[model samples]
Target: MSRRCELTGKAVLTGNLVSHSNRKTRRRFLPNLVNVTLTSDALQRSVKLRVSANALKSVDHRGGLDAFLIKASVDDLSPKAAELKRAVQKATASTAAAA
Candidate 1:
């Protein structure tokens, strides 16, 4: 699997590591990614995802996985996350319609 966040789509960034002697070396800045299982109220299940620490915090800040997925933009999300967002939206819409 690639070194990328499944939620925010954060990936390795290329940069230069400069030394005190003004020497610059090519380096990669990787996102702080972790494997986590987040529970979705809409799905009534837990989903495992590789996400950055910042993305994880944003998910929590948004209240839950379903809310975060709904609020996040499709352009910023990974393919899997975009799919999950659609599923969550569908589930919530159906539930709302039933109610």
Candidate 2:
């Protein structure tokens, strides 16, 4: 499988590295991904996901891995849920700008 973050949709990026001599070299920037198991009701089993460190951090910071599931209800959102959401959004925007 590719090194893609299923949670945040982050993937490896390709670009060029410019040196002081004005020479450019090809380079790859891989996302920080980890293989994690998440519970799934449809399959009645745990599903593995390749998620970025930032995405995982957002989930854990809000609650835990369970919150990363798409089907998870928002009723149980933590008191700091909004903060976490904003943080994730900001991070994503910053990444996009950098790219």
Candidate 3:
């Protein structure tokens, strides 16, 4: 669909391309977006999302999908990701209550 990262909200940025003669032309800087299936330990399921390379690394650094989504900002997450985050939160809360 769109050229945007669902996790980090990384999108295409407009900039200038300078030639050898120092002439500037319009260009776009695209995010390195990739489709990945990340598993959520809280939800006990895997979800596929389009995310930037940096976001993928962040997810790994943070531990897993549920961990990353729990700490992620609502403004940066896409609609689908936000929904997933909510679901994970609910599941985690219920598990905490049960324990």
Evaluate all candidate structures by whole-model CA lDDT and list the values in order: 0.93, 0.60, 0.95
Where does the lowest 10-residue lDDT sum fall in candidate 2?
70-79
| Candidate 2 C-alpha lDDT tens digits along 1-99 | 767665566678999999999899999999987877755332344556667778777767756553454333334333233344444456556767999
Using lDDT as the measure, what is the rank order of every candidate, best first? 3, 1, 2
Best candidate according to TM-score: 3
How many clashing pairs per prediction, in order? Answer: 0, 0, 0
lDDT per residue for candidate 3 within 1-99, as digits (tens), equals 999999999999999999999999999999999989999899888899999999999999999889999999999999999999999999999999999
Each candidate's TM vs. the true structure? 0.96, 0.54, 0.97
- What is the TM-score ranking, best to worst? 3, 1, 2
Error of 1 at 19 (Å): 0.6
Off by over 4 Å in 3: none
- Per-prediction CA RMSD (Å): 0.8, 13.8, 0.6
The reply for model 1, stretches above 4 Å from the true place, is none
Report residue 16 deviation for candidate 1 (angstroms).
Answer: 0.9
Which 10-residue span in candidate 3 carries the lowest summed lDDT?
A: 37-46
Q: Supply the global lDDT for candidate 3.
A: 0.95
> How close to the true structure is residue 76 of candidate 2, measured as C-alpha lDDT?
35
